[model samples]
Target: MQSPGIPRSREAAPAGWRETADAAIEGGDDPVPSMLTALLRRPATAFSMLAVAVLLGHAAAALLIAQLPRASFGVEAIEDGMIRVTGDDRRYAADAPVAFVGSDGRVRLARVMEDLVPELEPRGSSSEITAIYAERDRIAALLREPGLMLRLPDGRQLPAAVRPGRIETLSSGFWLSFGIALCSSLAGLWALVLRPREWAARMFMLSGLGLALGAITIGALEQVSLATGSRTLFWITHINYLSAYIFGFAIVALFARYPRPLIGKALLAGFAAAQGAIWVMGLLKLDVDMLGIQIFVVLLLALLAVVLAGVQGWLSRYDPALRASFLLIWISLLLSMGLFSIVSLIPQLMGSPDIVPESVSAAAFLLFYLALAVAIARYRLFDLGSWAVNVGLSALVLIAVLAVDLALVLITGGTWTVSLAFLTAAILWLPLRELVLRRAERRRDKRDLLLLRGASEVAFAPRPEQQTVLWSQLLDRQFSPLTIAPVTCDTAAIRADGRILAIPSPLGGTGLVLSYANQGRRLFNSEDRSVATALVALVAEMVDARAAYDRGARAERQRIARDLHDDVGARLMTTLHRGDLETVHADVREAMADMRLIIDGMSDQPRRLSDIVADLRHETVNRLVLARIHAHWPITAIFDDERLVDALQARVLLSVTRELVSNVIRHAGAGTVSIRCALTGNSLLLAVRDDGRGFDVDSDTILGNGLRNTRKRLEELGGSMAVQSGPGGSVIEIGLPLPSREQGMSDRSMAV
Candidate 1:
């Protein structure tokens, strides 16, 4: 089962699963506590190890920087090419270029510019820094010398010697940069661990790796006072620019295909080639904008791509869960990418000071990674479709557009060219957003109608077994859970943070468990639970109504069958044994009369209890006389004689009394029989007393078929029959329930 906080795995193929897809009540374990996190390994070993390795990599970067000669010029670049040398121990000239004489007799003139410290100074530029690149090889070879002659602005020349830098010498800024980079890498690995096959996750991880590489390499160069090596400096600059372009490419590719696929892998490859070429041009120093304008433009496209992706994802509401997942992805991408571009790239483009440190700006990428991690953990987990869409994601995107446009104009002298791009969106995007929401609402209504139709199919299925089948089918079609297992839950519930859902039968039986909603593409939420609850309730009501109808029909048929065996069958059997022709003829007539009563009893019409009792008394007396035994029943002794009884109850009452008389004649051989009737509580009480030779009533006495049939008739009316026998006589007691009469009926009943 797909559980929350874990990636969903492939569903195990159940035997004959295609026949029904998912079967209810087949016991299946909940897959909440998952072990298959990544590449068949646990998080501790796979993803955590990546973080540990990045930790070690940070130490290695620090160690490499420590190996560079510590110049300690005591002159820090305060701003664009401006140096501030404080205190007498400072070695560099305050207002003039410092000259260095290497062991190879090369005395190079120093010309300081913002290009030399573009990364260190907030407003530094690399425009004038190109000269050092051509001479980097010779200077790198000379740094190996033991000492060099230094000319300071103070006109004092001293021999400069190198001391090996310690770990303590590394600035806090360097640590912060590596730390941010490490965090970004870990975030990507975390997402990849959860969903290794997802392109969105893979691209997000790729972006993190790019961000990490760029941050660390730029940090190492910015920290270095003297060159590390001829090749090393070249490699560091190349890695920095390459990482920037890679980060941009990954972000753009991620936006193009995530939340919904706008482009395929082939187009993604094209994006890679384009971005890679831009990085190549930057490395070759082909133009003035190579390092700054071209790369920053790519970043701008990446941001625009994500915004457009988010817009497209929101508008295409076909997959509710996917749209929901895209909500987080879009908002986070907008805020993180938007903020970083504004504070870092725009300033560099506009020749303005950085608003925040580069490392801190890089920390904004962490939010992007965090959003991806959260989107991975949460998406493929369905939330309420419209709720996910309407949670201000579109507004945030629109706001980001305006904010970026405004920031660009405000930072870069407020140009109309930049402002024009966002002008149309700022005006029309909100209405377009509302239109999409309206479409989503219409779809939701249609979804509800479909559920109603499905419920009818489930509730009115001709057979109980078929009803169950249809029920399972209905749920499977609605939610499309990968696994629907058996659960002992009685009420509708969502478990494992919407990973598993329990849907109870309205008839109050064990329910089915649904895991990994949308075929494990999403988790279950309250919206799902509410949908399940509402649908099941409709099905349960119809099911209960149909069941009650079938139960009544079945019970009536059984009642008719029982009455036939006890009344008509018993009378005809008794007459066949009788040798006298007149007695046989009289018995056959009585049987026909009883059959008419049974037929009349099928109607819902009520009869007077007083008249039913009088007829019953007369029939019992005649039977006793026919058997040559005295019978007694007082006409007025029956109390509550005005009460009415339904036709079924009246029919049961007469047939049961007659069966008692038959048992006495055929088995008791009684001389005197007396009948009594009354109402007690909600029941009608009847007793037959016979004065005869007593028979065993308590010692496992077996009743004749006639007597057994009498008890069965009583049971059909929800009544009971009990026998008490002693030396004097045998007494048979019967109690049949008196259902409440229909409201507003007159309290009048006619006697016979």
Candidate 2:
């Protein structure tokens, strides 16, 4: 069954009823108007409509009062509680009776009819004869001319002529109170209409309604007292108490549910029973003292409930939103209570008149409700840590400001002390607050960075199992989930519990899961989710990179095996079969040199251009001397300024140079060879000229394997090679682009 103030859609109903309703609406029935009519029939909606009507009625009354004529009157003191007034003198008569107008705009006769009393002396009174003669002489002079005599209730005589003006100040206060009640009612209606399903929201609505009803009762009773000069209304006064009790109950209940409920069912039941008992006693007018005792007991219980709520909020460490909301509620309630005590309760307790108007208390209550409403509606439920921190710091600064003001007032006196205190506080407070906040933020940021760094380290772990272990450790340090285990479930669905995060395992599996139970009793927030996402992405990238590295290593080993089998293996076999020691030795040396080149090329270290040039010159000269050929390798500085080349580029350049020199000595039958290296623009230029019989150009001839490989290497390095051949001489020129300036400088620094 749906509650009167709750929506039907929120309550569970018979199967298919909602579906039928939806289908009927969708099939061109135009049920919106009907639906609205049904809504109006609900008790909650009817109550809200009534409240709106009441608000409009009060507004109209205020407008009517504004249209009334203005009246002014002069007041003069004649005696205690007596005044003489004269206005537009033509309106008053000498013998006419006069009246005074009250603040409710009602006028009553100021004169009282009573019998005159003759002065009598007590039998035991000591009367001096000279004093009695003087009093008799004064009385005889006043009796010379007899005029119309009148007496007031207090035995004081009224003035002969007087006038009264309209009184509206108290009327204005009543109207203001009515307006506050109207606003409270409307706010309650809004909360119920928007979120009637939530228990906390319902409690808030009830509190607002109670406050509105109480305000209305108090305002109306006070208004009647002002108009009729009677302040006692037994029935209506009890009704006011009932409304107050209801309001207090709802407020306590709301605190119990908000953030989290701390009180058990038994305590809640006890609270309800106490409130009911207090209400019954107040209604029956039985044992007034008992009623007071019941009220005090309920108050104490309510305070305990609020304290328990704060404790619960603190215990739920991960729910920053709840903690923040509770803190705001605590601050607002204490402030309101303090103001009420100072301005109203304390004065009344001390038998003094109220120093502040009742409207101050009304305003404080409104502020408390408004703050809670904002916190619930606007702040995210689990992600208010930063906001909570800021509010706490701001409160501290405010306290500091107040303390400074008080200290200055004590030391400097009232004469300009307030201004000086404010100035000093502004100068000192802002910088200190900024410094503390910055430091706090820096610490938080550092912690976040550590989480990221830990994840990155896990990404680079050598083994997949090791990565999982490290990832689990990172999660433990950060979130501290209750358990970590593999699950064959959907990895994309991330779930969380109080201080626990359920994330997909980095290792590939449908059911692999890593559950983290956090150390603090807090829930995983959006920030934790973001960090986890980044970690997963990094791990995926690192896994891909590792796979690529392994594949490349395998392919390189195959290429090395093929080169050794096809070149060195064949040459050594031929030399061994021919029984030629010199040929075998030469083949072994060439194989060793080839193996060294391959090893150097596979290394990650870079080589400088000058170093490569020197190595190339030395190797070419030694090869020529061993081959008994005149070599004119006049290669000098390759660059005017020193430059660094990466391993791949350097290997390609050296291989091509060495291959050209070897071809000249072994195949070309050249008597002499000249090598030159230089830089032109951003390109490195190498020229190898040989005085040997050159092959014919544009002929269909298969090039040697070494030449083919050299050409392929130059193409891969984004460079081109040109060959100019003739019977007299042949030249091979290679041009390669240099690295960018910044990269060259970085490499040079590293090399140095």
Compare the candidates by TM-score and give the number of the best one: 2
Q: For model 1, what is the alpha-carbon lDDT of residue 65? A: 71
Residue-by-residue lDDT tens digits, candidate 1, 1-752: 23445433323211222222233323455553132322234444566667788789877877887665554344455533355443443433234656666667577546442222323321113444355554544444444566676556565655554556777777777788877778788887777665566676788788889988988975676565543444566667678777877777787777777656777889779867877777676566563545565646657776666776677667655453555566656666666677777767776777665566777777665655665566654533445334444434644564566566666767776443345647656576768878988998999999989988888888887777877778888889988988777677767876654567888875456678887678766667777888888987798888888889989899889878867776788788888899999778778877987898788888867877767787777777887887799888876645345667777677778777877777777677788888888777667788999987768765545565666667766775578999998778899999987655453222223210
Per-residue CA lDDT of model 2 for 1-752, tens digit only, reads 11133223322221233344345445444678568545543546655676778678666644543332222222222222234442322322223344433334344234311101111110111234224333433332322323312233333333322112133543555666676677776776555554545556677778777777666655544343111211123444556666666777776777676656655657766877777877776545442443344335445544654565566556754553345456565655544444444555454444443444565466655655565554443223234344444544554554455457657756865422456666887898779878987998999899878976886777778877888788778767766655556555433333422123346666565323334324434435557666667666666677777778888799678656655554456546655775657646665676677667778877847777778788877877877777777877664556334677787677677777877776676567788888888888767888999888886645546355666667776886677788888888789999877675466732223221
TM-score of 1: 0.49
Model 2, stretches more than 4 Å misplaced? Answer: 1-194, 208-249, 252-371, 374-379, 384-457, 483-522, 526-611, 630-639, 672-676, 689-701, 722-731, 740-743, 746-752
TM-score of candidate 2 on Cα atoms, chains taken together: 0.55
Error of 1 at 527 (Å): 9.9
Question: What's the lDDT for candidate 2?
Answer: 0.56
Deviation from native of the Cα of residue 223 in model 2, angstroms: 16
Q: Which pairs in model 1 have colliding backbones?
A: 93-153, 380-521, 380-522, 381-522, 381-523, 382-523, 498-524
